[model samples]
Target: HRFGITFHRNKRSKAAINTELETIPGIGEKTVIELLRHFRSVSKVKKASETALSEVIGPAKAKIIIKHYQQTTNEN
Candidate 1:
């Protein structure tokens, strides 16, 4: 029973991990779409340098946006 509970929790955690970019602090569905259009994948976004991200996301939001994704990826 305890093992089953832990497995369920782990599955939920993994799902949450996969959606971190979709849930980024200032990013909404539209922005996520735009990001996908520009980068093709969350992995591409994550792999971008701050300067590259700024080019796509803009300077005002780039630092916060990149930092949010970086922190989430680092945490996981």
Candidate 2:
């Protein structure tokens, strides 16, 4: 607190959420932001179809994301 930085509860929550998304393979900050903006939540992003994700983040990135989720789902 000595640095005079104000603690924003909302930002802390957002950071935590972003961190969770980043755990998914091939998802970086920009990709996470795009997912958040498009799908609005981790579950939605996970549930998104390859085509839907491609619509938001492009085909290459979408394939990576879709594959990661598909692998995760298959493992469970």
Candidate 3:
């Protein structure tokens, strides 16, 4: 199957999950590892505060992550 983007945590394929996160600006493989280590899951990451995320991924990337989620939130 072709690679696809998905926000749903139920996706069993790691490629799908990684592809989705990689779409977020500034989130590459290293950051993805950091995020997963810090938050364990996407839901946890989505609910994390900027300050908490900044501590994990630095404030700049934290802002990007927060903004990305916020924009996705507003769009829904």
Clashing residue pair totals per candidate (backbone < 3 A): 0, 0, 0
**Angstrom error at residue 7, model 2:** 9.0
Q: Better model by TM-score, 2 or 3?
A: 3
Clash-forming residue pairs, model 1: none
What candidate 3 gets wrong by more than 4 Å, as runs, is 1-19
- The better-scoring model by TM-score among 1 and 2 is 2
Worst 10 residues of 1 by lDDT: 12-21
1-76, model 2: which lDDT tens digit per residue? 6343445665656666545668777778888887888887888888889999889989998898877777877999
- Report residue 21 deviation for candidate 3 (angstroms): 2.0
Q: CA lDDT, every prediction?
A: 0.74, 0.79, 0.81
* Tens-place lDDT digits, model 1, residues 1-76: 9999999999757544434467667776666666667988888878878898778778766787878866777999
lDDT of 1: 0.74
Winner by lDDT between candidate 3 and candidate 1: 3
Worst 10 residues of 3 by lDDT: 1-10
lDDT of 2: 0.79
Expressed as tens digits, the lDDT of each residue in 3-72 for candidate 3 is 4444333354553455456789778877987888778887898899999999998999999999998899
Q: Model 1: how far is 46 from its true place, Å?
A: 0.4
